[model samples]
Target: MFRAKNLWIIHLLGWVLFMSLPLTIVSREPDANFPMLVLKSGWFWSFFLVYAVLFYGNLLVLTPKLYLKQHYAAYAAVFVGLLILIYVSQPFEKLIFRKFRQEQGREARPEMPRGGFRNGPPPGLPPGEEPRPMPERGRAVDFVSLTLFIVAWAVAMAIRISREWRQSERRAILSEAEKAHAELSFFKAQINPHFLFNTLNNIYALAVSSSAHTAPSILKLSQMMRYITEEATEHYVPLEDELACLENYVELQKLRLNAKTKLDFNVQGQPDGVKIAPLILMTFVENAFKYGVSNHRESVIRIAVEVTGSHIQFFCQNRIIERREDVERTGVGILNTQKRLDLLYSGSYDLDIRNAEEVFTVNLKLSGR
Candidate 1:
């Protein structure tokens, strides 16, 4: 509202300056008689009143009604007609001034030098051509009017076009933001159900055996579920909070792994003030545990996270168990993670996966906004 008010104030001041030009500088003369000067000034003010009406009428009314509605030909025609009316009215305006001077002459002297104010068109003009010479005062007024008409029309069009462009850009930004929010919500919904199904299977195995680690495992699972349900719904969570959730998940998975199976997880640097998308790192870690561990043979799985002021890097590596089923299931989580990365971070992140020599390694890097 304040911006709108400021615009109106500027417009009013500009028109006020245009109206005051004739009284101040355009009509002022040092040597002219007092009555003649008044007569000359009247002619300028009369022309100015009509010119101002036509200029503002086009800007505020005709431009919006016709030009904005795509009626370009009609808009041009209307303005041309207005210009023609202004040009034709000039002679009648000069006739009014001539008559006033003649009346003053009857009361004052027998003959008063009229100077350059001509009763008719200049001599030696070709057919259908405009008069070459005019009264000094009338010529100055004509020049000012023509220049002002062109300038005012150009300025009004420029301001209107700029305002429309800004409004269109704002609408596009709002639409894109809404679309991203909806897509992120849908992706997160997929992640939670898939993860919970796998975690529940692990807990079922522990309950069937009546293992000592079953109670602790359930407690850890409860904490991780709370994190997923509460914190994961948000767009960003503190890096420290996300790391803590990762720790809980790894601890829960340890119950299913034998002593011979190595599951090492480490953090390298401080994660005090950093923020990240919640649960973004879990897919790779889950994939590592699912296919990288075996009860019969010794298996090694390693996960590491490094943090700096500007970026965070994550690494997960696991020896692939020689099983077709395990290999196929691992690809599902990794593919979903790639989709999420594209949707959320796009150009601000990097992910590399190596699946060769019976070993799988996943590396991810995320830069801060």
Candidate 2:
């Protein structure tokens, strides 16, 4: 399909509309020599031709090459020279028209009156007598030409500068998108390795102990890996899919937990039609299992997910049984998750992490897609 290259197509159409004004003049003055008025009128077509050339040339060439490129002195000098030429050329063009008329033995037409053309005689002219012709008005023509020149210059500059600004903004958006993609890729690389190392260690411990849960743990791990590989890499996934992956991870982690560990995982609402950033809530859940479980004490890890319309809330509260030094070691995952949230959701989500006394909690709220 054909598409417009840019806004220049619209700009060209506007100029064509303006150029058709000569035809309007021809229609209003049917008895006038329309071709001679348009083609031979020194201040009309000459002014339009010069204005058109200056408009496009200045915007398309001089602006990008000189003005936009910071060749301020050269750009100003060239424009000043062009203006001087235009000013001088106006009078010379009028003189050429007069000479042409004289050579053809045609009397110079009277200038339009100050208030513009009137079909009847002036107030002072007697009835049935023709009014004396007005003399050529150089100042009026010059003023009109100058006004047109200024308007064309202003409009061209405005359009060109606006286009350049939009282009710059578009480029900036593309650059930011690329940068965010690279950063997200780097984050995924960090997360996958760290998570795999921990999961593999748990599987190894289970296999070495000749535990009956080893095969089930491996099956759950396979499902978790599939989720991570296929769905987590995507920008968004169905909320149900993410919740299922979380369930698999929680089940796999349960295989290695001590008997005293109390874990409650609950989903409070339907996830139908809801979508969210994949694995966004998993890091908090993982941290709860890592630092909340204890062999000697009653340890509790609570995870809850609530969905209402397109709103989602995730809550994780864990009894912190590890020492302060060990707890600090778990910051990597949470920090990475926070950065991802900031990049992806920015102002659209809220994440609060609190640690008071022996309890650590994560509360996250989001407007899901």
Candidate 3:
């Protein structure tokens, strides 16, 4: 089916579109010398048809060797042969004209065979009756056509290779960028575990000191430390994993400040399959435990998460009950998280932080993968 379609289109569009200039001139020239007009047009058309057939085949046959194998001499030989055949057709033109006329009523216009025209001269020419000038010089026509073919072939090949090279370079650069981002995250992880280890050690000190609430604190620290070290070591974790880690950290803080600290953090959403950066939630949780939980005054921290479709919202609010005399600002957690969001989310996430009156709050909206 494809071959048949190609054949039909080539006859219609290819001949009519590309060869229209010459075909139109021959068909519609207004000069009226009936037999002479047919004679000249027939001879030239026959010669041109043969030249086109050979020239197209020459391109397919020679271009691969010239570019891929760099066979310069083979390219030259092909051009020489093509020039010879095209020039020689000028001499055959008169003969072809005579033969085509003889066959108009002698036989039906020869059925076109495969590649191109299929008719050749029949057997009725005696020994010594040929035209005087047998078309000696066709160098100008031959050179013009051959040079155009070479130029077009070279341009097409260069464009193809250059496009492929640019695509490969773009892919390599993107891969290197991704690797560097992963390494930076690893550096950040190192800092995270250091903080977790110190908190665990503090819990251990409380236990070995045999404080009255040591057992519950030890268990809380165990769960929180497991979550910090184990769950936050991935590119993306489930939303539930992050929430669980946050709750565990808050519980440990509650154990340490036994009945003096309160936390109100909750989540109600699709808890599985939604993906997020593993440690993004921890900075807010850590900040709440550090500065908001007061043992002797009114202190409360509230956190809520809502997820729908590919969007997620995390809201955190904590009272600045233990604000130091000279301290009037948020801490390193929010700053580092701001930088991380700039690096990882860019235009894809929104963050708001406010410290008004005695209350501090953070609201984050992020996209899930």
Over the stretch 164-264, how does candidate 3's per-residue lDDT look in tens digits? 57778989999877975776475466448645765786677777888776777677667766766676666677777777767766666666664766778
Winner on lDDT between 1 and 3 is 1
The candidate maximizing lDDT is 2
Model 1's alpha-carbon lDDT is: 0.75
> Each model's C-alpha lDDT?
0.75, 0.78, 0.63
Runs of candidate 3 with Cα error greater than 4 angstroms are 1-145, 176-180, 212-220, 223-230, 258-261, 295-297, 308-310, 321-332, 342-346
Off by over 4 Å in 2: 1-9, 16-47, 91-106, 109-141, 324-329
User: Worst ten-residue run, lDDT, model 2?
Assistant: 91-100
**Regions of candidate 1 where Cα sits further than 4 Å from its true position:** 1-5, 16-28, 31-65, 89-144, 322-348
Candidate 2 structure, TM-score to reference? 0.80
Stretch of 10 with least lDDT, candidate 1 = 108-117
Model with the higher TM-score, candidate 1 or 2: 2
- Provide the TM-score for each candidate, comma-separated: 0.72, 0.80, 0.55
Q: How many residue pairs clash in each candidate?
A: 0, 0, 0
